[model samples]
Target: MDTEQQRFMNMKRRVYKIVLPVLTVSLGLSLFMSAHKGLLLTINLILLVGMLFAWLFLSTKLPLRVIEWFLLTLAGIYLLTMVVQGVYTQMLGHGETSLGDFIVWMPMISLLMFLLFDRWPALIANLALFTVLVLPAVPAFPRLNPEQNESLILFYSGIVVYTSLAYFLHQLYRTRAEQNAMLRFAYVDALTGIANRHRIDTWLRKKVELGEETGKLFSLIFFDLDNFKDINDIYGHKTGDDVLRQLSKVVGEELDHGDLFGRWGGEEFVVLTDTGEEESFRLAERLRKALEDHDFGIAGRVTASFGLSVNRPGDTAESVVSRADERMYHAKQAGRNRVTGRTMVSGDG
Candidate 1:
């Protein structure tokens, strides 16, 4: 892949890691506080700091170093909290619990490394369960009694559910990419790399039907290479194919938005310009000259004849195409390598 595409992929990966985790963490924190009576101001501050740190860390280098640093920092915070909680309970003449709580923050710690970051669903799902799931588990960990084992079971159940859901979503993205890739291969020309004749037929039919009621205009520019068969016979078929590929590349570069280009068949192409004959022909001339100036392999510049026409009232696709094709043929007869307007050659249209 190119550098630009690689950069886009990296940015997309980073966005998924950061956005999903943060949202889940925030939601989980809210639920956790709401379900418990011990949501102290200090603990909330600690939660906010840790959550912000996790977000900041998500965008950092997701290697083991970042993870190690985060875990160590979290361990330090927990140690301090344990000491402080001890002091508070002693001052209030209440018993301080012996075992520590850890699984209460599963939403914040599901990912150990950024490199292994899953897609959005994993993080978002954990975020949603933070309070209803983790808040109630404060007294559940560290060898729970039989009565408290339900919290542990529920937490593990959530893990399985989120993992399964995350796997399903990743498959969804993968399947979509594969489908698009296959469609592109099937409907696009392999030589010129533009839409093929099949695509033109399917796409144009839909466009015509759609705009019939909307009153929008679209034009089709018929194009044919001037004396392309001679080039193939003299130079060889491979050279001829190369010339067609190069010609399509030039045409593609000049194509405007809303315009579609395709290879109709051997040495023939079509451009759906979606504009009046004047604008369509203008672009055709530009494409013709571009092809006539470029060199590919040993073959020299190539030239083409083009004919432009708009859809008439009650016009079928075949009729409009025949009219444009006739004009292209007239241009070929009058002189090869010339572009004609909407008029067809005698006995042609």
Candidate 2:
């Protein structure tokens, strides 16, 4: 699954984790408060049993979508029961006809709707609930006192206002999520799923600017698979792609925290680090050795030519990259599978 979908499912799981326990505890209390043998007690027991079942399945590997639908169905049934109870009580002349019991619960139900669905679905569900509440009030309006009329108006207005605000907030959240997804797509390489060249360039420029301001040094290691073209030529590009992916995974594991690794284009990669010349050289040698030791299955033994460059005073991103590129070619010329830097060279020349 993609990161966003995973995040959404995780969020739903967390919501269920909290909501289920709270509902169970509340129902347990209601059962305690109700008469031990009546319909109210019986209904609470049934709900508590359902809640327990939901909690059990939640702890298991039940899909969150199914759980969500189950909860929403329960909510629908509960609302329907409330409406029926209100109508029956009014008909028996034992309760007020103002829908006070049902209306009082609307705000909480509206919040649940917003939490459980996206913008339009939530809005539509809430509007349907509002209509249900409003329809019953319409026929009784002329019989209501002025105070009751005002209360009803205020309640309806509040729901409308709250729904508008919720819709606005959901829209804002969706826009932010879309922007984040777009940014991730732009900066990450599609094939290897590492930072792409654009991200590397942006990172290098920022590092250079930071170094210029703070007088702190940093380094770059530019490397590419030796004879990568030959691999593509002989084994075909599919196997070559697999080799590159495996190579990235291997190199990525060797990097220290705070180091930035990116694909600099086909078969070429770069590493940016806060370490100075000596440490950077050591890191490059480690990467080279790691590559040498790894077997690339059908690609057989494979190695990389590395170029190391430390930041110099007044160095721009282009200049630093150019130096690393030059040294990398020098390493290739000296013989592949070696690291070449300004004052140091490793491997058989």
Candidate 3:
């Protein structure tokens, strides 16, 4: 996974870890506080137990998406039970049929719906809940006293307010999600699932700026597959794509943390690192050896020509990448599987 997606998953796990325990405790307290017996008490007990199970499930190794759906399902069942209780109490005439009292949990339900779901789903759920809450009042509206009419007006007004706020929040969330997806699409290569050229260029410019400010140098390693077209011609484009994907995985395994590897273009890849000239050359050599040793299945053995270039004083992003590209070309001309920037060191130096 990419950094942003990994961070998002971690954040979700933390939020759920805290929320599940709080909800379990709250349900336990509610059961204690209520004077109800029989079915209502039994239902609350069931809900409390469900919350405990949910908490345990969250602690398990299940995927986050599964956990999210499970929690939302639990919430739906809980809300449905509450709706039944409210309607049954009104039918039995056990208490005054105050819409306000009956819907005391509506705001919380609305907030949870928006929090747990995306825009369209949350909106639909909220609207359905609102309809269920208001439907009972519809038949009795004409018989209500003036004070009751005012209360009904206030309830409707609250619906409008709640919906407006929920829509605003949903729009904000949707906008942010779309922006993140767009950024991922722009930066990530579709086929190999690595950084694309745009991302590489952006990282190069940022490194250039950082190097100029702190006098900390960095290097760029550019490489491309040798005899790649022959593989496409002999096998098919399908095998060629498999070769590129496998090559990316191979090179990725050799990279250090914080190293940026990207698809520079077709059959070409780049690596940006915080290493100097000698270290970058060593990394390039290691990568070249890795590609040489790995079997490409149907395409057989595949190799690449590598070039290394360290950041220079007053260097532009283009200048750094161009020098690396030039050296990569030199490596291709010299042989097909050699590093061309620096002297070859012995024994994986």
lDDT of each: 0.64, 0.81, 0.78
lDDT of 2: 0.81
Ranking by TM-score: 2, 3, 1
- What is the C-alpha lDDT profile of model 3 across 136-158, one tens digit per residue? 66766676556655666676677
lDDT of 2 by residue, 1-349 (tens): 4876889888878877887788788768755774445443454566568767877788888887777667667666665555444444442244353434334445556666777788899999889877876776677567666765676687778778777888887889889989997999799988898999999999999999999999889999999899999999999999999998999999999999999999999999999999988899989999999999998999998999999899988999999999999999999998999999899899653
TM-scores of the models, in the order given = 0.59, 0.83, 0.77
Q: Please give the ranking of all candidate structures by lDDT, highest first, separated by commas.
A: 2, 3, 1
User: How many residue pairs collide in each prediction?
Assistant: 3, 0, 0
Q: Of models 1 and 3, which has the larger TM-score?
A: 3
Name the runs in model 3 displaced over 4 angstroms.
Answer: 1-18, 38-43, 50-104, 111-118, 139-160, 209-215, 342-349
- C-alpha lDDT (0 to 100) for residue 170 of candidate 3: 76
| Residue-by-residue lDDT tens digits, candidate 1, 1-349 | 3764567557755665666476557646674666333634456556556656666665677753454456535634553453345334422225333212444444334442222344555455345433434443454344344434553466457655655555566668768977987888799887777889999888678667755766667788888987788889999999998888888878888898778889999888899977776777778777767776777667765678887778766667787788888888878887767777764322111
Candidate scoring better on TM-score of 2 and 3 = 2
Better of 1 and 2 by lDDT: 2
